[model samples]
Target: MPAVSAVSAAPLPAPPRTLGTGLLLVVLVVAFEAMAVGTVLPRVASELQGLSLYGWASSAFLLSSLFGAVLGGVLSDRRGLAWGAGFSLAVFAAGLLVGGLAPTMLVFVLGRLIQGLGAGGLGALPFAVVTAHYPEAQRARMLAAVASAWLLPALVGPLVASLIADTWSWRAVFWGLVPLLALIAPLCLWPLRGPAPRVGEGSGGAGLLRPALGLALAAGALVEGLRSPGPLGAGLVGLGGAGVVLTARHLFPAGLLRFAGGLPTALAVRGLAAFALLGANSFLPLALHELRGLSLTAAGWVLSLGGATWTLGSWAQAQAERRWGPGSRPLRVRVGLGLMATGLLASALAVLGGLPLWAVYPSWVLACFGMGVGYNSNSLYALAAAPPGESGRLSGQLANIEVLMVAVAAGVGGALIARLPLERAFALAFAVTLLAAVLGWLAAGRLRRTS
Candidate 1:
């Protein structure tokens, strides 16, 4: 509502030529791998006889990515965005190889950890690219373009993986991604080849290296602690929580834990949405199959459909921003979070009450759509809030928080599903996520106050 200043306003930039296309390509490969993995993870679990560790398969990626994101951010700040982005892609490709050939669940998890590291890095650096290259005015549309990249993959990834899983082997899904990564990595890194952002003399981007590792440990401990029962579990949980709080304080913006106003609140909503939506998403396939009696293919379709709608919401937001201007962000974020909360609540109700199966599909679409809109808005808000020269670090911090909470949510939710009855476990999981969504909705209120 206040007058926008030149420093903060998203001035129009030269029209993006190849930069946007290359970045979208990068996103597509990563997204395909992710969506494909989800499609076959159940099969992977069954084949490996590691059904109990199903959540870890996904959590391991998220856990390691937390450190990867921080490392990437620092490296980008200290060196260049291209350097960070390239490194993450190489690491990600190797992870696919490792995962494709994994002989057991332990090995598979290791591969996931490696892949996550790259994903975290790749995830953060793109924002840096946008920050450095695009004007704030073009950011929304640019971000929407990035979101749209996921459309094709979302529409086909699951089906492709399912077909591969059914006809050939799950390993093919992993192996197949390797070559594509090889092709796209260079293109993705090309636009980033120029002067990098300047880091302050004493900012010591390198200094945070140790803290990144510490954050990863804390993440793992939190997941492990939640999974474990009894005194030992409680102790691990406590230790992990403490580590998270301590390490996060350094890695994230100040006052994140206290839900500090402005950028802090925006970051909170991002993490909370990940915690709420992805936590449930991680297990939704399992729930669909176990509780609702849907087949694996059917479950995969639900995920694909949800992804498409998420993209739709993202595009819709982009259009609104283009037409209505930046003033629309707060309203868009509020609407997105509200939809997310509503969707989560609706799903929980359907699951808990044993309603008709058809109801779940629409509920999920709403939730994903909410995420598409809110998550994208949060990125713009966070980037906008960054002080001059802090965009990369802030983006990394946001990514780190999002991945960390998702890891925790999935880890804890998976553990619950393993131990409890299907109905009760899902109910509790949805409830926890519902709580997270509500928290995010509350957090959205502060977005306009930032910067």
Candidate 2:
């Protein structure tokens, strides 16, 4: 005891409590908004007579978020995390206000676009914070904590939103959260104040921002084309597809589409997984409400169940990482992808093959749980591999890919839904998701770099 060194005797410093709390609160609020909106979207569409534009509600946000993610990343790298975070939070709040007061579907979509800008930044900043602030050992735990933030929101958000919508108005759901943002803003920003620690040479604005704008515009065009009918729609789709192809090369790491090893594969896996799970999830409430004849509250229960399992799965992966170490990531991702595919297949059968309606609950749970496991693991893998001073950029790229894929999936699904009967459209959507999951599972094997 007398020979003990002061350094050895001291316990490791924990991550800033206020900062972590603020970040988690941000995640909590964002997750709640997502769940609530999904639950109430049918109602919104019906009231606003926007069934044709149902997909735009989600796509617009995602597309605009593409720009936000890149801009936030650039600002975080150059100006500082606090500056980017403050700007993002403010934009997010403004979007909510606009959405709450929207007089028409067009106005509501405009609000969503604004929200995407802020939400995208908010989504990417946490990863940058984790990279800059936390030690390697604590990173996984932090990511898991972020996932855990979804727990309360998932458990109660949809149900509460449904109740609010029934008792008051869906508009309340958007307005209710704005004040909470005010409370959390200080907690998150205070710890991150001042100049960002010098890491490396910051990337320039134009190279990233230009592509981000192109990506968002391309995605928007694609969604609109999907919703449109006739040859004009086909032409728009082609144009959007070409634009995405050209712009994507500038935004993502090289060999992304081909699933090159390490970062590329990880990003691809995450994007495809999100496309499968979230794409299917977007249509789930609608399916339950329209095809299965469930009440909004009952449909919300299904989503809540999925959210609960998702949290459990995330924690389980974290525990596994603790026990087996980082080497287990590929296995975890592969296993999660398998479960997702299985769940999606089961969901499709339930919708089309005459399986009982209740089959969807367990199936969704499995799918979401897989997402919880794989999505977090993918983030860890990518962050661990990030070049010095590029965490913000990497995080933005990751968020961009996920957002883009989900937007496309949802937009395509909505287009189908508008064209086909409810049952067929939902079944086909599930099939698309299932295919994505299967492909992601195959790609999971490539997560590690080859010699």
Candidate 3:
């Protein structure tokens, strides 16, 4: 019950150090794959031309990834991060190959589902490895470095994918990643060790189910928005909603659902922050290419800036955390969200004011910077708060919950865009981002006081 960490701040997690370079390489390939696809997605959809299913394309990856993360955590807790990560890598690669060759939109989605499944484990496991292997004090820097790895993909992935899609085929984007994964998988071997324990007894019956439910709910909302082909989506939503209620109770702490604790509030804010960022990300490129008539390369340039800005923001956050005390963490996070709200609002204004398409990018860059700062703050906060041995459970649940919100927001937000003019759609996105900022401030405030 005592506050300050019982764990020492020395001897950084053995796993990341032992596997530092290798694990980072793994993170880069994964980040690159995700970033690259974002660049080419607009072109892919343009050719496939299923405007209604656009969100589903991304959500398929998110929803399956939700389940995959839960499964990974449990497996990591049982089989260890090494095996968990390795299995995920295999699945992830299969998904890319499958997606690259998809003839139809539905099949393409199937590939995304596979990718998501793999992603679930891929996304959270590294953080867990870092936590379990290193000292608590080492976490902030290691996590930042982990984040910094994204810098390259952000800077390069878009432009690379854009050029490939324009010159050759979007399929090249996936094909190119195959080798990256092939190399990254083996590097995990040095880090793979024995199983670590969960944060708690893992909540009883529905421990890991919360994320799936969240995914289902998100997909359901998308279905609600689209009224997609059959009732399957609705059914999925109902199941997800019910599961969210029951499983969340077990997955999170006592007051998470109610936002009573700083941890719960912080985690919730993280989800909203993700919603604001990802919903816009899902829409922006499409807006540029589909509506504004920008080529993939042109649109990618905008995305590259956003990625670069994200890194700058993260760098700023890490610097602030290091220079200031622990309280600085939430403060930086709040600042990040405020910036996002401002950026999104600015973009909305530009669109409404009939500003040139190129003019709106500065705001988009700010939004991405906000994401980098806000996400890292929330993640570090969550990981730091978790009891030792529970890093995997806590981080896994956090990742799952956040992604579920993102998937739902994308589907719902994407559809809203389909219904509105460019300005109106962006206006809605701006409003959502603002709300997310307010929530982030409140959530972060809890930590500000607690620390």
Candidate 4:
């Protein structure tokens, strides 16, 4: 009887369908807004006669979202994912409504600030949900799916927004998303209902808020400073830079600036990757339009194509992980960063050298692809390394840092463009991105230690 016994391996649990659907919906909505907003902002400014506060519309959302990210992380850890998500979504919806109904630019900026609070939390909450709900084996696919959600929006959001604004009104862009949010809210929340299981002790409290506020203020000052001219701009820059340095310690993991090994380094690399890719991307359209004599439409197409390729790269990493195991992450990061650097260099040549206009397409594609691969890899590493109960905090930090770096990169690049000639400004901007990518590549080895 004993000799007749048989052993069978248990099958892995299937992925969470509702959770996946809800997350994808969230990503889709957010991505669409991100893609479409720029198209309609000009209209918003003109209609409101808020050209002077134009930059603040974007800056207010960004800075407020930084605070939201921290607050959401704390809520997720303490209150549970469902509570945090619901609260964030409600805030976001309210902001949309306010923006849609806004009569003045001041009112609209207020709405944007409100939206940023919710949006930041929304951005951070997904990582906590995935970490808490999805099985370890399935995380890669889920992340890849999230990346894929951006593809549709990336492809059509701008064009659709433009059409909507042309046919209806720019406010329609804000109003349209409300119904979609209503539909998605239940799907996401129903599954997440009830208290989140405590994986570890809750960490951040109201104590962290001061530093978060400081960080947000610092970012705002820096951007405004970059936009300003002369002594006042320099003073603002110095103050903002000082504030960031002083406050960052409270928000980021220890040794982040020094690139301490493991999780800290991984987080640093993520920030650097964003700095390199997004900074370059922020200016790519301008470069193509001004330098290469491409029409705005043609330049937009290049961005859309780059976005699609980035999704492809994300999927590629997921598949690679499935075949080769999680151990492949460090190599993926390194290769991705290296490719990004190469692409930036190519873009510089295409714009500055005698290369044909067509050259920019391939170069931008390469850089975006690298971003897709490396960015996801860094995320996986950070999430994996997060201590129990700390996923939300870490994820929020991740979002916060990326946002901060991007703001800095864009601000610096914009400042250069404002002061220098077009060619020289672009050259310096590309140089900054290139330098970031190279530093990221050099630091990527630390990710292996965490692995």
Q: Which one wins on lDDT?
A: 4
* lDDT string, candidate 1, 270-347, tens digits: 899989988888888888888878897788788788888888888888887788777667778888989989987887
Q: Residue 210 of model 3: what lDDT?
A: 56
Candidate models: Cα lDDT each: 0.82, 0.84, 0.71, 0.85
lDDT of 3 at 142: 74
Worst 10 residues of 2 by lDDT: 1-10
Query: Model 2: residues >4 Å from true position, as ranges?
Result: 1-13, 39-55, 103-105, 165-170, 199-204, 288-296, 449-451
Say which prediction, candidate 3 or candidate 4, comes out ahead on TM-score. Answer: 4
Shift of residue 243 alpha carbon in model 3, Å: 5.2
Model 1 bad stretches (over 4 Å): 1-16, 42-55, 103-105, 165-169, 201-204, 449-451
- The alpha-carbon deviation from the true structure for residue 186 of candidate 3, after best TM-score superposition, in angstroms, is 2.4
TM-score on alpha carbons, each prediction: 0.91, 0.90, 0.84, 0.95
Candidate 2 pairs with clashing backbones: none
- How far residue 376's Cα lies from its native spot in candidate 3, in Å, is 1.2
Q: How close is candidate 4 to the true structure, as a TM-score?
A: 0.95
RMSD of 1: 2.7
Residue pairs with colliding backbones in model 4 are none
Q: Tens-digit lDDT track for model 4 on 1-451?
A: 0111011123335645887898789889988988898999999999999998898898899889998998888777777888778888988888888988899999999989998998998988777777777766677788888889999999999999999999999998997899999999988888877766474544665667789999999988988899789999999999999999888989998889988877788889998988999888899889888988889999989889889988988998888878976777888999988888888899788988667667888998998898888888878777777677677787789889988998999899999999999999999999998999999999998765332
Q: Is candidate 1 or candidate 4 better by TM-score?
A: 4
Deviation of model 3 at 160, angstroms = 2.4
